[model samples]
Target: MAEQTQVHREQAGINAAAVRSAETAESTQQRLPRCRKLLFQFEVDMYAKIKTERLSFIRHNQTRLRADDYIYLHDAVADDRNANRLGNMVILPSSFTSCPRYMHERTQDAMTYVRHYCRPDLFITFTCNSKWDEISNELLPGQQSYDRHDVVARVFHLKLKQLMDYITTGAIFGAVRCHIYTIEWQKRGLPNAHILTWLWFHVPSTGSMWPAKQWFTLHERRFPIHARHPTVQHLSVHLENGQRVYFTEANLQQQLQEPRDTTLTAFFKLCTLDDFARTLLYCQLPAYYTFDASTKCWKRRVQGSSVPDHPGIYQTDALARVYTVHPNNRECFFLRIILHHVVGPVSFHHLRTVEGHVCATFHETCRRLGLLKDDAQWREALEEAATVRSPA
Candidate 1:
């Protein structure tokens, strides 16, 4: 159901992008070379026809609904009060992604949040500028942002998650009590987010305190927006044409001295010894323990952190985060799901071993534990039925 919701969200975005009027497309300079403007226009036209056909098909074939003579009914008769009436209509429910009902429910949810937390302190508008270096870097030859909106959309989604993580984790404007956002496409065909954030403490003006430029700028004092443990130097390097370079500790021992007493190793060791450590999931370690590279061990955190909503109680969240796993990868995906419950397994074989019986694969193990709540009963029934049936 969660996966279906995700799929619905993605399709909603794609459909919205697809059916948007080509007339609303931003005009580039008359002199500038056109890439796939005609292709985009064609896609728009096709999407419109597809949508109309789909609605018509649904109207005919789908369950027509009406209230007495208007909703959830297969057929309806004209009422005495009102003579003018059509057949029972196929209504778009709240589950229809960005339909009127869905949008209304979403708005109501935001209103409920506002009522709970009061008016938002920060009103941030995050624009997905196609000019971002990340987007430019990924574009193939002869391709523009408009040409590959999937890529643009994905990059925006990832960056939006990062931005939200920063805000919610109190990296900016302290902690946020609650946040609600809506994404809309501008007249320029660029997507932008209108975010309303309610901070924990009252602020006179957030803009004056933390300027937009500072949020974007990669200052020396701020944490670098680079990947952690990134390679200091590339293997294929041109020898200096009188270009002076110093040999540092990183140059000598970067590859060599990857210490054995890292977080994972220490976690495994601690799991064997410490009862408290054994209770923790893999990602929950950061809530109680901090990794010390110099000391080469996991140190217990004396002071725990709190979130905006749960200020009184210590939370395992925010201290660590795991990357989202796409459900398509069968073995890897199932293994990741299982690891949420079974943690600090010393080896891969140990991970596979559940309840003293080592399963052949993660899927079998998941079935054994009833993990992911898959249709195991139906699967088993099919296997049993296949044996009983004779070959045709």
Candidate 2:
């Protein structure tokens, strides 16, 4: 009886080795090619769309900037109000630089608020770090350094769209209001922004001022915009000869009317969902592509077809191979569902090369729900069972 038990243990070790070897082989076969393919395709597509849309807009024959255009631009400014004073103002952390694409939108928002609320004074403040003094000295004469002037300008331009949308919509819930602030703090390795707002609302004669804690809690729940990451970059246009080039909106428009670049057009075509998916498939499968519990259905992406409702085994091992490469690849899964129809038009939404760490965590979470089998070894058995028939 002891000899038989030893024999069983030896057999189990052999089976484990074989399973590990098979998993490794399968993983290697699916990973490398998928990563290279997906990333290359996405970059090509994104470049094309930007070039086409941006360049084309520059060419249109609109000579006169209208009142509506100014209103659109004004909406980008932040809002500040004091109790009973009913003034609207915009503020930013004093390190912003530039954004050309959204100038009009910012102008519109600011103008709209001023017109409606009777031109509230703009209060610009700076959140200066200790390093500002050292950086200011190094700046060329007449150059704007990391001071309040530069920061406010950049913040106003960078977040024009969001600022305008909030104020015009009349969604003001809290007493004090804040707007966008763009800051650069890379020198200290903590570069980013924090939007600070102060709210003041009317109080009747009998009512007392609300406590700071209550005010902050309400502010957090209602006006929750704060500093985070920088979303856009400001680039300068230069001539092929390495000289700085300046062109007015009229000049850019004139150039656009003449001819369009074919290369730009082709680039956008490549960034579509199909191209992105194809690239991702070359790298890896999703780590955990299972049915969402809240949604109560398994998600699948098919070319040119809407995702179908069905029960399917979670392909965890297959997904793990791809996710081992890039963690951001998981976002592709969510994008695949939302942009199913426009996969070919969108460039950045593919999940084929995500890193396995995040994928594994997601897979384990799904496992708890019984969507995935506990052991990969059971895959073959599951496949075999699918083909077997029970005697009637």
Candidate 3:
């Protein structure tokens, strides 16, 4: 019986080694080639498109910028309701780089129409991480395994488009009023999407007073936007090279147990949900309460440190840190749905006070319409176009 057991153990070890070897071989053979092939195809497509579109002297006599024209431009601006907003507004320009080229125009049109119909509070961007190689060897059915990068990119784009359409069209964020989006291809030949949304509700501003239903509370354990270390609990805030960085050091347990330790605990709870407090505390790291060895009590450092000056009157401590439903801080129960959950590589998300992205889109649109050569011509064209109803 002892001899049989020893033989079985040796056999199991051999099988494990064989499996590891096979996995290593597969990783080297499959992953590297797929990435390389995708990259190569992207480079070729980008070069081809640039040569055909950017440098093409083919005069598109069309006086107005079409939805399809904005599909590939780095910056695309639209006049009318789809125009980006100014002030403390939230704009989500989400891009999916996996949709088909032919579908871009129709998708853009449908999104604009829906945005006009629904009228939501703000826009949020959506991106999906690709898993083409995991799903199948060939990019498409009937193509050679190694030679399907183009088809794979196209199919992936289409899949993302379908997903976004279902979600934005009254699935997740409720009714959207007006929105605009763009689809662009990457250096790797994969398609990416940029979607803008405006909902029926107005996202509450930090300084202004609004109805109670416009805001909600956020807990630290539920939404952890703070920087915390477990092994070394003692935290100090200081500025270095114009950036907020965290440092940990060994300290006596007695000092940590004092009231000073509670500052971080309490501040983080407020910081996560308080946009106004967050802005004040952003780059300016305030000093925390520290135990003076002689005094034997907590004493806050007096380096001109002050409490956050919020604009509106807070009813309670909980109400002071109330936050509106923004994409980056969006949470459902104990789970963070957007920031912590969504998987995508190329994306941008933040709260904006100005429409900084609008100029680039406007200029690109003008250039494409051949109105960029002369300022007089461009101004005249825009003035003439303003008289007519804006494009759908």
Give me the candidate number with maximum lDDT.
1
What local distance difference test score does each model get? 0.52, 0.30, 0.33
- Candidate 3 TM-score, true structure as reference: 0.24
| lDDT of predicted model 2 | 0.30
lDDT of model number 3: 0.33
**How high is each candidate's TM-score?**
0.38, 0.18, 0.24
Off by over 4 Å in 1: 1-35, 61-90, 142-147, 202-392
**Local accuracy of candidate 3 as per-residue lDDT tens digits, 187-254:** 75445665655555543334323223321111111111111100111222211111111111222222
Worst 10 residues of 2 by lDDT: 215-224
Candidate with better TM-score, 2 vs 3: 3
Candidate 3: misplaced stretches above 4 Å? 1-123, 132-148, 185-190, 201-392
Model 3 residue 36 CA deviation in Å = 7.2
Kindly list the per-residue Cα lDDT of model 1 for residues 1-392, writing each as its tens digit.
36445545555765666545332233643212243676666765766665665455445433322212112111222123321233334466565556787775555455444434556687888889898876776566677787756456656766765777767763467666667677777887777787777777753324433234422222112121112110111111111111112122223222123323434455666777766667678766666566665775766655656535533434432233333234565665566556667866665566678789998987788877876476654464364334334221
- The superposed Cα distance between candidate 2 and the true structure at residue 275, in angstroms, equals 55
